[model samples]
Target: MASKPMNVVVIGGSLGGLMHGIVLKRLGHTVRILERNPSPLLHNQGAGVVAGNDTQDFFQHHDLTHRSLAVTSHLRHYLDVKGNEIHREEYAQQMTSWDLLYYVLRANFDRVESGYCTLPPVQDGEGKATYQYGHTVTALRDLGPDAGVELSFRDRDGESGKRTADLVIAADGGSSTVRKLLQPDVERKYVGYVAWRGTVPERSLSAAATAALAEKFTFFHASGVQVLAYLIPVPDGALEPGKRLMNWVWYVNYAPGSAAYRELMTDVDGKAHAVTLPAGKMAPRVWHKQKAVAAAALPPQFADIVAKTEQPFIQAITDVLSPCNTYLDGRVLLVGDALAGFRPHTAASTSQAAYDALMLDAMLRGEMSRQEWAARTMEYARRVQRRGVEMGERSQFGRHPYAGTYPG
Candidate 1:
């Protein structure tokens, strides 16, 4: 009455892949996570992410704690550049620090591996799983048509090795090497806007300034641009008694091929840096312009918070989607940004990753055959990917606000 254990290999040790590995391991499978980072400490572990009830269900189902939830604030008002208040909607949901979520999930995963047992605890075959950091998967090749999947990777010491698994899950993010190998024609397109983000201590501002940002999400809209500000309780503690941090994002339209665009995308030393800009290197002066714009165009209360911040970071917004009907290839399946990278407008990246994990878990449990799983999961991905593409198209030229009506 015992079921055989499945050997599964997951590429990318971030949220989606880690979640998939955890769920499969729980279902009596031998799961291994191949992480390219040197170690767990080197991961970026993003700033903050938003999630709704459906996402919360995934966390709760996996026995995760809610204590790590960040400060929740409702969107109170949307104001135009002239300080005129537009629509006001209340979003009653929870906000959380992305790093906190990753840490919590990672901790829970470590606690679950006591000693895997067979389906009915037969005297043979207990499942075992491992997380192998510094293993960068380089190639994935089909092993005939019946041998399942084979993965080639390089370890920390630059040693090359190969692995075979019954299933392979690729959650390697936007510039996913797996995706590039499988589907060469698909590419990432840059939107005409750059997102500048930073955080400042609440105590850095005066009393009036702090009150303006107190426990509420606020957005300031302008023609072809928008700025959003919110208070997120750091992993350390709450907002009172000392000081909490306020996170801010400014969307500015930058012509793709102009000099200013090149300068804005340049590195801190004024040298041309290739890929997207990394965190915390933007010159203070460049961000000063954004603060000045906010001060001149937004409500005085919101402007005051902007003027008090220091050392903001900038990133170019780009859109990437999978080619038609190809999110999966044989035993390897793509998830999260690996499959579809969306504009930040919907704030749905984390939620979508959670959904992928849940659906994939069910499929691995034999609830659906490999063919059925690929069809159903790809359909789900297509729907979400379409929404993301529409959002990206609307967000092009930087004409939408976080609180405005969704463009059809």
Candidate 2:
């Protein structure tokens, strides 16, 4: 006789959610993803992401093949404000665009037509799973000592409903509703700086400018700010000739609750902006000032890359820790950034998510009891989160005088 399938509900259809769903589905468990967004196509934003060797293994373990990976430019050099090359090292691995990764993963999920709020059964077997979009989980209830837990959600049409599952996985991102419901006491803290990111077409730059920024990855470090630029390939070679895009990010320190903070956080129309920094809205004058700062401070090669940028965007950095206690009343599980969001310094955000998926897969496979799984998973999360924090603390490049400098 075959064993019974586990009914699993994964909240947040982002990278982590999808990853978990795919792995669980492969393991013969019924999986469903609940996403608040209306559809997956709404996400058009893209960013360059660096994945290390560990990440490569994580991808392969989840059945992500080489064909699914995006071709990214490798890291080449780090330069100081005066155009002098400070450090040069060859990156062992490559980088890729976030959109490419998402697209590949979504295709791998193989149920894109079904929305996350609908909860329509996509896979049929002894174990069936589904994803329901526009379903905002409002509350969770502990169903007695023996029964499984219950989840309450607001559907797309604002109708409220409840469902019970053997396991609940919260991969819902930094602002996870499941996390809030499970661990209401945990708080999110803002880091001391904001990140400005944008992409420019290679054709928009002169030949010399293009040559200067054609590297895989490059960083420009100055006194109070640092800029990073990298190359990304676009489709349509020669005939349509899509320009190679240069993705750049600028990190500037800003005091919390200050006028400059307000100004920097405000949109071009003077309205408060949230989440991502708006593209093409910043004033040309402000950009010119930034360019001037780059020109005056950054090394010649790095400054040239910044000067070639079309429109630079900004985003405030924030960090959040998972609740100190694991197991929500001994039922729900929180994973990935939904538990502990780190500063983007270590480039481990995606890697950590991959780790969570693998670990959860192992635990759900009956390698350990539910309580033991929770303890071990939480320990792994804590260790990863601690690493992220350490990297973030050390990432104070502009604020610290000795940052990016090597002692002879």
Candidate 3:
């Protein structure tokens, strides 16, 4: 154990917050994760996440459940518009549904029964991890050096409460409230594009589509569009053949402030979303138009997969990087997407969260100082963020020398 145990408060009980909370809890610190979402389960809108190296390493080190976490694909195929393979490579990738990752992390942290993870909670001595849902942090106060920070929040009942912690982690995502409070000047820049994403059940894929994509990470790149498909574990965390999900993402440019952008962002109820239009909420005409474009531009297999999808979502791509991550005398940290939101081309967001958590662990264990930890995390964030921008530019605009390859 360390010389002192901390009372840590993690704002945002998503992947980033959970990873940090779990690590701190295992190091004998008491952790409380405050999540704004009132529901016991947070939905990822049927999206898939790349299980990068740090993500896998995090589970190997911190999660005691030791469950298999991803669906593996050992081949990559770049197909022409006619569905014939233009290029094939022996590349392996691990993919997981966002729901699976959340359930697994939640199981390891607070042992919340989400049905997806039925394994018994692992044992840790002296440390406690608790999650409070429907809590929105409203204010933060620093009490001088080494004196900890206090947070004011409103619960689901609209009741207000205050909590103080030796350390506070803000992993609240790209549009982070904490970040806005601390660094008001920081902003996210839209990348003039959005991803049209959807998933079909493996069993729903036709024989030809299955044969082309079942075990391969498949891609079809056009002039200004790129679509890729791969398998991911299903909602219930099953990875068996025909039980997985065939997840696909198509990147298409939509110039900011254009009429096309406006229509794409306006949902079924006429609510205009700033970043994401979730599954089942997209306007019918908008989706119909996109589907028509897919049919004309995408490979037959890719188009079929898109057509079979019941509900598709849209995520507008953006880039955000904070000048610094640590604040309030090292008692508060802006972590993960809160610190740096990258383009999805890198698929490094989750891995960035894991990396941040592990670096925090190292700091708490006296392997590094707080300044060192902050610097290291920020450096990694910048590198990945830049690479993501380059990769997106290369694929969508053919403007960069960077190859159209994802971070493995």
Candidate 3 TM-score, true structure as reference: 0.95
Off by over 4 Å in 2: 1-3, 42-44, 64-68, 72-76, 113-129, 202-215, 233-244, 280-292, 304-311, 368-376, 397-408
Per-residue error (Å), model 2, residue 257? 0.9
User: Which consecutive 10 residues in model 2 have the weakest lDDT in total?
Assistant: 113-122
- lDDT tens digits, residue span 199-249, model 2: 667667556555555755777554456667766544221112245566677
Give each model a TM-score. 0.84, 0.83, 0.95
lDDT agreement of model 2 with the native:
0.66
Instruction: Report residue 204 deviation for candidate 2 (angstroms).
Output: 4.2
Residue-wise C-alpha lDDT for candidate 3, range 92-152, written one tens digit per residue = 9899888888888888888877667665555747489899999999999988766779899
Per lDDT, the best of the predicted structures is: 3
Residues 208-293, candidate 1, lDDT per residue (tens digit)? Answer: 55655556677765555666777765644353423567777777778778887887777678766443665666655666666777
Q: Give stretches of model 1 more than 4 Å off.
A: 1-3, 65-68, 82-84, 111-127, 205-209, 237-243, 270-275, 324-329, 368-372, 392-408
